[model samples]
Target: MASSTASQQPAQVWDESQCVAALAQLERLQAQIDDLRLTIPRVVAPLSPQITKRPELFAAFKKAAVGSQSNIKAFRTTWQSQETQALFEHTKASLEANSDLTPGAQLPRYGWEQKEIRDRDAEARRRDGAKDGEDKAVVSMSKEERERILQEFRAANGQLKVFSKDDDRDILIHFISGGLKYRFHVVVNSETNGGEHLDAECLGNGEPFVSITRCVSLRPHANELKPLLDMIAAYKNVQSNSCAKCGKLLDKSALVPTARRSKQPEEANEKQETVWEALHESCLD
Candidate 1:
């Protein structure tokens, strides 16, 4: 019984020679196959059949397309007046009915407010305000009003030149007297000067022109006004500006403001708070 069992078991053979022979046969077969492939003419693949449409099928398709198009065309005019409008109203009503809350029903709010859209709207408002002559030192005046004011000033000052800068944020006046150019700016509040309307203070005909001492004297003597013009040109065009009273570098903050002479003859005597001079606070002290 033990011998029969041992004979039934398969024998494990370790033959290197047979394995080498099998590998040689495989290599030879592969080489012959490769050579045979090279010797044979390459078979060109046949072109696919061009799918020509059948006359009857095409005709049927055209008929169907024409019928569909005609049907659409027939409804096009009346669709807006009848079906489309009715459907739109029905949809709107349905949406409203669904959206409306019942007596005791609560709906969870999920969406957030669009901040980007809000920011864009705010920016647009700011730009509109700026374009409408808001926050300028010179008040917002109509073209007619501006012309009237200019004519009034020109009549008294004798052809004064006016220039606007910083999108008309600042208005510069050049008074040509004694063969000298006396430059001055229309008065605007230094604090919050470029901010919106400066709280509406610059909404009307802006404050009167303020003087920078000696730039425009009651009398335009060449000797007195010419040197002052030179100093003003230097002060404005260049950085360094010294106080007239004290030869120290004048700081914009340290400068004290005094009422400027009014351009309006009617308002000359009235107590004006327009800043005419920029003097050292220490000098005032």
Candidate 2:
């Protein structure tokens, strides 16, 4: 308990300037220590995912992530500040440093090569997951299981109202977002559909929901109802992120919230997920 309490202390924020200053102080302290022929236990860099087992450690990381603007994704591109770039470089360097380079196994380079390697790794993971997914394939669900899942799903969301419960496999639901009611037809996978997944389509939008579709078929997930929830949340995000100026969820280009407008523009850029007015890039003019 004493060691646990000691380890969970709030981290000191090490901005670039602070890091430089600390290293300078450490140099002077090391000289003094050498003069006295004394030594002290150095700070060991943490390699554990359990570094954030305590709430304080988690909050500290959250603070650093927010401070660096590393958590922000704009137009599906990550906002990598200098601090985050340094962190990325250090992470790759650390892996190379620790790895046993037997003969010619090179660490992935930061370019198209890295991306290709990652893509290959992702494909391999998908193939592995597909074999595992066979066990929990939506086609294997019994009528009672399907009905119960749909009922629990309907109960979970206030926006989704059941339009029809006729087919146990096909669930038709009505959702309200941006003051517009949208109907969705959800079909759990079966042999007819090539098995192992479920997906939805907005009756009004005519094949929208890129995120949910990707999530349902591509992403490896254990929860069966996550894609359904994602479907609702996607519309909810569209509702909450209406263009402040034009009062529309989508621009004339039919893009939903690719930009943001805040009273404090610097804060909007610097901070993570601020209470900024969401907008489409076309509406900025």
Candidate 3:
């Protein structure tokens, strides 16, 4: 029984090897047949019964053959010479010219180009005039004019006042003058109705008070004037009265009066205060 089983196993192994070899040979034969099928021409022979019976077909074939030969010769000649590149360029240009169906499509309009140039020149001139005008205006003011303006500003706002030695009036003046382009000093004295005064000094060739200074007397609780400065900066561009806190739009009539501390007290028990304000009405809501 053992010998019979061993003999059966060898027979089964031989059969499996034979099947694998047969499949490989079949695959190779199929691949060769596929290659031959692709290489073979699909068209019927020119001398086939249908073509042979038609006289016109023979004439057409002859004409096609002659034309093909001529084309081949022309291609050879052109490909072997520098004139080939020039001919290709000429053909491309001709095709491009013919492709443009629109009228006056070859070049842009002269008037349009001139207008663009003129507009640019005008814009440049306007910008230069604006820059020069600003510089001149800032530098044109005399020292006396600056002093007078400062005095007027202080008087109108009631900023001038005399205080005790420990008062922060001098510090407040420094803050205001620092905002100006020119280096001006603030002088506090008895004659000055406000607690502050500005000395004569020439600022550079820039806009006067272009910088926003700290108004220490107003909103003394605030540490920095950055919020007001930002508002002022934005105001310089768009001339609208907006709420400094909420950025809501406000009308001229919306501004109200407010009080600020003054330099001195007229009576022993009473304190002096400056009266002016521009609170946006919308802010109250």
Query: What stretches of model 3 exceed 4 Å from their correct place?
Result: 1-138, 159-285
| Candidate 1 global CA lDDT score | 0.36
Candidate 1 lDDT over residue span 1-285, tens digit each? 123223322233324333233334334344444544432222111111332456755565556556555545544544444434443444344444455446213311211122222223444654665455443344333445444554554454445565644444345656543344555654323334422221111111211122233122221221222222332333233222345445565333333222122122246656752222333322432
Tell me how many clashing residue pairs each candidate has. 1, 0, 7
Model 1 alpha-carbon drift over 4 Å, by segment: 1-139, 163-171, 176-181, 184-285
Local accuracy of candidate 2 as per-residue lDDT tens digits, 26-55: 343434434333111111222246585677
Candidate structures ordered by lDDT, highest first: 2, 1, 3
Candidate 3, 1-285: lDDT as tens digits? 122223222222224223233334334444444544432233223444566546767775666556555555555554544544433343344444455545435422222322233334444654665455444412232345434544544454343331212232221222222233223223232223222222221222212221111121223212222222222222222232334444544333222211111223346545443222223322321
> What is the C-alpha local distance difference test score of each model?
0.36, 0.47, 0.33
TM-score-wise, the better of 2 and 3 is 2
Query: Which is the better candidate, 1 or 2, if ranked by lDDT?
Result: 2
> Candidate 1: lDDT of 72?
50
Q: Name the regions of candidate 2 deviating beyond 4 angstroms.
A: 1-139, 192-196, 205-223, 237-254, 257-285
Highest-lDDT candidate? 2
> Please, what is the TM-score per model?
0.20, 0.33, 0.16
User: Model 3 compared with the native: what TM-score?
Assistant: 0.16
